[model samples]
Target: MKNKLPLYLLLFFLIIVNAFFLYNYLGAGDQGGPKDQIRPGDFLVKELGLDATQQAAFRTLGREHHRKMRGLLDDIKELKDALFKGLSDDPSHQVNVDSIVHLIGEKEAAKDLEVFRHFKKVQALCNAKQKEKFAKIIEDGLRVGGRDQGPRGARPEGERGPRSKGFEDNRPPRPNGPNANRPPPAARE
Candidate 1:
């Protein structure tokens, strides 16, 4: 046990250091997702035909927008916590449920409004062509991630559940493509 103490201490220090770096990276930096957001930046350059100086200005505006978005999300989280704390102790009791729900809805709306406001602020910094490109990208994202949709062909697969005929066969084929050496499928007599 004594000999293992140093090893454990070393591991703990490493964890602390890693967590410190992670907090710095994730806390305020890169608020706008990742390289995909960079793709949006690229689209603005290509589709809008922005000059280098304009692109530089847009990057600054994008960073500010990301910072504002982070602030709004933090505010929303605080509001949610306040509402949660205001609730009654009894979970099943309906007391304050309606009020809490309304508060949460308002908080969400505020967050959404902040997002829209930031969008417009950034858009205002861009020329007409840049705004057009941004709108097209936003529209594409809205169409790709529809709420009612799970994934392509989801309904057909859901339709083939255990309740359907041939359900057993639909079980995933063994990793080695039918489990060649496994006992043959039970005689389908």
Candidate 2:
């Protein structure tokens, strides 16, 4: 009976801890649904304040857009696989690899165009006030890191300050020292 008492106490403690965890975990959303489950079109209904009719249209548009995007994305994945597989074997397959990369780029451009069209449809459904808010949302989404970082993030390759080049090493090369230009260490060893 004493042995059983300890086991019963341990089980009771575990049950209490599990109930506490489940309560907090489920309560985190406050939206009364599973934490991991996402309702795909809920953002339009909730964030954009879409009416029932608009929500239905948005959902339909979203579904069709996603279906088209899925095909493009899958083709991109397949082309990427073929390109990498070429890399693992023949150096002579460079032409084929380049062709695969071009196809992937085309598919990506199509997917991006589809997204732009989808958002344009969404914007059309917005009211004057909602359209203002929607414009802000799109603007914020497009900005790099949510704000223009200016030259710090936007400088072109050769236009970056001289010290920013990969070979700069931030130190003057030793004059005729052991590390001096001896074919850049590639031919030494």
Candidate 3:
């Protein structure tokens, strides 16, 4: 009976551990639901104080915009793939890199245009006060060195001054240091 006691205790401990793990695994599934999840554009909807109809229209617009953007992105990816694949081709059959790059740029431009049009459509949906708010939002977004202008080394208007050491000016200093007025020896070759 004494030897069997340890076996029974071990079985009980394992059952408890298994039950805990099972409970945790099953419990995690219940934590997520449509109501708990924040969907894209929800913030805009809330900020704009859109009516049900407006919200529906906005969602429809978003879906259409996303579909178009996806198509454009896929096209861009295909172009990029062709561009890279051209690297392996025979010298005589080399792809026109510039044309492919131009096409990629055009696709990117179209994406930007699509986004602009989308926002314009959203602006059209707004009432007077909402439109004002939307305009302010857009204005802030477009402002130079604004919140949207992420860490690309762009400083706010007043922060601009004479070039300082350790500041990133987007151009690296010449290898010969600050006093290097002449071109490198390699360039002379």
Candidate 4:
């Protein structure tokens, strides 16, 4: 009984600690923080330690990326609309359903590529330290819903939470996208 008491107390403590993390992970996680407002310009200016003049130039780059990517999003939305409109009560609609799914997959892939490019742009602006901070922001961002900071199933990379905005994976960071040849440095890394 004495030995059992120690084991039971350890189990109780483990449960308490886990529950605390679970609560924070669920209720007050990523979405409750400033990361929600973090844009490419924010990372370029703050994380990379850029000057005010450089910050202005970086903002232009962010605006351009946003503009180009948003156009792609419009096309993706059109695909979604087509998929929904294809749904008919006819039992022979399987072929249309399959096609819609395939089109959605293509749109999703393109979106993911764009996200990868954005990451590359941001990384080009960073030296080493800023990259670490960018990685932390990404990991934290992935914790938006719950403890699962990864794909639960075999969903497409972009189909996950971050893709709707950006970022395909939330890990130790990868060399996503083609690195920018040269971005005029606003400040030191």
lDDT for each candidate structure: 0.70, 0.78, 0.82, 0.70
Q: Number of the top candidate by TM-score?
A: 2
| Per-model C-alpha RMSD | 12.0, 10.2, 8.8, 19.1
Top lDDT prediction, candidate number:
3
Q: What is the lDDT of residue 33 in candidate 4?
A: 75
**Model 1: residues >4 Å from true position, as ranges?**
1-47, 82-88, 91-97, 147-189
* Per-residue alpha-carbon lDDT of candidate 3 for residues 1-189, written as tens digits (9 for 90 to 100): 998999999999999999999887887667656666666489788888999999999999999999999999999999999999898777765448878898999999999999999999999999999999999877876885365756654445435456654465665543452335556666675
Clashing residue pairs in candidate 3, if any? none
Instruction: Identify the superior model by TM-score, candidate 2 or candidate 4.
Output: 2
User: What residue runs in model 4 are displaced by over 4 Å at the alpha carbon?
Assistant: 1-40, 145-189
**lDDT of candidate 3?**
0.82
Model 3: residue 104 alpha-carbon error in angstroms: 0.5
Where model 3 places Cα greater than 4 Å from the true spot, the runs are 1-37, 90-95, 142-189
Tens digits of per-residue lDDT for model 4, 1-189: 987999999999999999999989997786777755765466447656866655676677678778878987898788888777866657688888788788878878887898788777766666587778778877776687376844455344344453345444444333233343333365326
lDDT comparison, 1 vs 3, better candidate: 3
Give the clash count for each candidate.
0, 0, 0, 0
Q: Candidate 4 at 86: error in angstroms?
A: 2.0
What TM-score fits each model?
A: 0.48, 0.59, 0.57, 0.50
